[model samples]
Target: MTIRQRLNKQSICILMLILLMMIVTACKSDSENVEQGINDLEADSEQLNPSEEEEGPFIPEGKVQSPFNGKWIPKEAANKRPIALQINNSLAAYPQSGIAQADILYETLAEGNITRLMAVFHVYDSEKIGPIRSARHYFLDMAANHDAVYMHYGGSPQAYSYIQQTKAPNLDGLSWLDGIVCWRDPERRAIPRMLEHSVYTNQKHLEDGWERRELRKELKENFSSGLEFVKEGEEIIPWGQRADYVTVPFSASYTSSFDFDAETKKYVKYQSGNYHLDEEINEPLMFTNLILQRTKIHLIPGDTEGRREVAVIGSGTGYFISSGRAVAIEWQKSNHGTATEYIEKKSGKPIQLNPGKTYIGILPQNLEVSFQKKAINQ
Candidate 1:
């Protein structure tokens, strides 16, 4: 055979080997581990329910209601300062532990078309919170709404500028003064994840973080979120608008789908083709309240990293979703330090939630968000 033919045969063999390696790399998730997680979610399918909302909205004689979820608790815990943690969202940050405990989550585009999360916790009880990521300035704006002490690792220049200008209460896990609150998981690090993907925060971090930042634990007397809840025995049935399922187009790789079960009266969350679960609680992270807060988004001038600005504050169009339906609503944020208000466009009354865990989607206005009467393939 000619030398050219022999070289051609060798090149074909190399290309075939490379293609096989690519296929294996893409399918390398430990199947046994994934199957076990799916099994656990099935077993723990009963964690969240609308029956949790059965209590009267009226504050009992001595009990205080949480401003976020409207659950009754000691008055002392009622108004605790919220801690907003920035959790990473790359595929490497899989199984974000303890996120289901957050009272509210703010999701928006970070770098690329990908998204990031700022999870606010009033009770401060999540044991494994993150491979905690950097801060986004607009996320800080939401954190400021609750007077939350912002906790993050690193941050973009824009975020740091906002922190400096507002003198916002913040705890940086990467600061020489505060990195003590963050620890690298030995096993995770051993997995040889990118160093950024191995860091996590625990209860100890919470304790020290508060001490280092000199922040208070609870709210002052008479503080309120001004959030309304649906009256007992009432449902948020939209006026003939179907909303049994919604799919958010956050990115080509990452999006979230929620299914409302009439029997349970809770939204079962699915993301990236799996039921999103709290690995710690072994339960699907369900919500009685969900909002799609759509707003104008823009790219910062001359920015190469592709971080964009999200208009979360000020008046905008949005949707309040519950009970297998959605109502068009207007969301207003009066100023930097004030809480966001969701008002019914038709009745002009404040939108009331179902008094259980809530999910808020901070989506770009231009994205093609859609819903269905039936669910996407499970």
Candidate 2:
């Protein structure tokens, strides 16, 4: 062969080999780039979004909010006024029929040493409520605050007078007295509370009563509860001292205590050394917030039963308990019609409750209220 031909062949071979090497190199580089890119993407994703455990609870969906609890309620229910029910809390009233459904519960002395409850039912549809008792005049103050339709068997002369003066919408069992709005549950295996404790109210009568009375069903204007709230699932309470247990003795025979449960972030209610359970749910009612108010409770001159008259509409001192913490608070009201605003003693801001049901307990000004973080309550 000629020398030139040999040289050309050698050059062609070298060029082909060079091209093949370049192709292989390029392929390897692409593979490495893809692997590096995948690693980078994964690292970025981990940094941006962590596991749910590291994060908090899922944000609640829906815009409709309850002015009562500040939780999401149905749009239909949001504007509706709550039902303020006067519930008996006597020993005969053990295992209250429907109080667990209350958005807010007011525990106060009605008459005697016995404490009574006025449960303002909102966002809950309880089938049967109450061996309903009579209403005390101060209860009207709370009832009017929420614009709730007051429910009771009977009322004191003061209460009846207040009801007439305010022109408040009310449902009285005394008008029907078990004939329509309420009933006597003869099968209730409670202590012989006589025919009195047997009275129970159902939803059917309430619907009927409202339609008959032609009262305002839903709110027309924007209404606020004037409460502050922290984000949900947060255990940190901005105000208040950490307390494991809070006890408020209403009287010698009747004292109620609340034990905070860290697991549920709720307070389990105990009254007279027993857990206050609901008859229907068979569960002790729990509250997210417990308010202890020491106010000027007076004796009504003509009230033969010694029905207590709590001066709830005036400025007073109270303790707001939630999330195992208690804060000193001041409660004030412009009038009986306005909600008693609970102000943080230090911040001067309206007391914000944990995001759930709340219980407000009003004691006589002289009653000793205590809170402790000891191991016995823990």
Candidate 3:
């Protein structure tokens, strides 16, 4: 072959090799770009959908939020029916047991200008619950509103008649389950007070009694307390006046008060001129919500013991105090089978309570409730 032809062939071969190298480099760049694109997509996915641990604490399965207090609890516990005990509030029964654990506490006038408490409990396993007293008819209405099992030592004639009419599931300390589920406290009996104030019950005894009675242990399907709660980390400032301290007078002789603690954002309860405490724990009773409901309460027409009848199945005005603030509210109850609805007067919306215990005072219409921006002692 000629030298020129040989040189041309060598040039062509060199050109082909150079073309192959360029193609390989371009392919390598494309492969790297594809890999980088995939990495970017993965990063975007991670940003959009964080892991469970990154969002918040992991909650175990079979847990649900409690309707009573808006706290997380086991589904089983949340589904169980609440228990309402007619706790004696006589001065002699100071520092009642297991009352601090109550999800809801109710104060109303009993006979002889004395006040009584109906403590409603859920998600609790208290060893001791009372100094249980006799039930008043109105308390049964409240208990039925919560779908709770009622417990009392004995009841007024009106209360017994109402129980029979409603067929409410109740345990009576004066009945067949006296020795089995309730007994007179030896320590209390040793005191000089009447034997009526000595009756007490505990969790274990109540549970056994419930089982024996074959009462429904679970709450009714789709049951709601008609209580709304603020979301976590949400701040709700009421438009009403500040209430650092509140005083509720159920009767001329009986008064209940609360002092707000800014640090804990809860109200420290004071009753009978002292801090109310649960004797079992010796801790002062506190609450996160306070509701003073005004209702028509009057003495039964011909009752010998001065048993009072409370009008609970009606609408009324009230005050709701929480987070060191007070707001006027309206409450309505359609019937005994329904829960009370508390609506803010300003917004005309159902008031949302802070997550914790609540104290309700069913005051008479004529009573004058008062609150101040500062503590009374301060």
Candidate 4:
């Protein structure tokens, strides 16, 4: 062969070898890419749908579940009785302090067609709480049921009589501890806000009063809240009507409402045509559970100021609301010293609450409570 032809042949062979190398490299790279994509898909699937064997949230040692809300709390606070404070809920008492930390709150009718709030705190260390109000006789029964230390600015004649008869441990703002444990807030004492709604107190002050009075801080050995809660990872499918919005009317003048927040799965409170916000944090008051308890309530015969007498120690029909739904429930309080039992009407079992804060509204039987599947304004 000629030398030029031999050189051309050698060049052609080299070009063919180069093409073969490129093809092999491309095939290997495509295979590697496919393998990596499968691995990524598997990882994503594991994250989206966790295995049944996977564990839930980790709880630290020396922690115990709270009887009030079913949340984990420090072990030291497990046996400690909660504190029930009477908070003013009038229009002037807007933006009340430290109520967001309450594990459970109760609302009941007071004089003048207005409602009062009783906040029960199991684990709280806030700097301020209240706009403290006077205690009613029915509130004392609730406090006793929780074995909580009661704090109030003053009391009605019936309330004082009940306290004297039961010998319940309490700290009265009208007593000598007025300046020591409870005090008047300077801001609230200003004009436009009534002086009667200026009382305020903190956790430290309450603790001091409790220690001085030698009140029992720990719960009784056999005491129970009689509240059931769903387990972790469990969903509550209420077998009743949807309740995205709830309206609780105490009287023609005052009505309390709640709107369900889908993202947070909580019901945000509204009163006086505005959101009920906390003074300290300026955050809207929300609750995970709401219980509207219907019972007999009326004014005392021949009594002035329209003071109300609520019958709490008996069985009654009610509704338990949570997770944007509500279910009919029966509430029974056998006696003053025991916690109220709530049973589901459909299953005839104890009503189970979702883990978080709860609000119990003591409503009159004659009043009408309504709920809807969607927000009123939206």
Clashing pairs in 1: 79-219
What would the per-residue lDDT of candidate 2 be over residues 314-374, giving only the tens digit for each residue? 8889898887888889988888667778888998878877778889898788787777532
Model 2 gets an lDDT of 0.80
Q: Give, for candidate 2, the lowest lDDT window spanning 10 residues.
A: 369-378
Candidate 1, residues 1-378, lDDT tens digits: the string is: 999999999999999999999888767756667888998887676554335565445556666657877666677676668788898877767777888888787677788867787788876577788878988889877887677888888899999999998788888888864457888777777776567877778767876878866777766456556467664445656663788888887988888888888898989887765787777887777888888888888899888888899887788877888888788888889777778888888888888887677888888777776776344554
How far off is residue 326 in model 1, in Å? Answer: 0.5
Report lDDT (CA) for all predictions: 0.78, 0.80, 0.87, 0.88
Model 4 ranges off by over 4 Å: 1-58, 373-378
Q: Give Cα distance to truth, residue 269, candidate 4, Å.
A: 0.4
Cα lDDT, model 1, residue 327: 86
Task: Report residue 277 deviation for candidate 2 (angstroms).
Answer: 1.2
Q: After superposition, how far is residue 372 of candidate 4 from its true place, in Å?
A: 2.7
Q: List the residue pairs that clash in candidate 2.
A: 228-352, 240-326, 240-327, 241-326
- Model 1, backbone clash pairs (residues 3+ apart or across chains), number: 1
The alpha-carbon deviation from the true structure for residue 220 of candidate 3, after best TM-score superposition, in angstroms, is 0.5
TM-score, candidate number 2: 0.81
Ranking by lDDT: 4, 3, 2, 1
Any residue pairs clashing in model 4, and if so which?
Answer: none
**Index of the highest-TM-score prediction:** 4
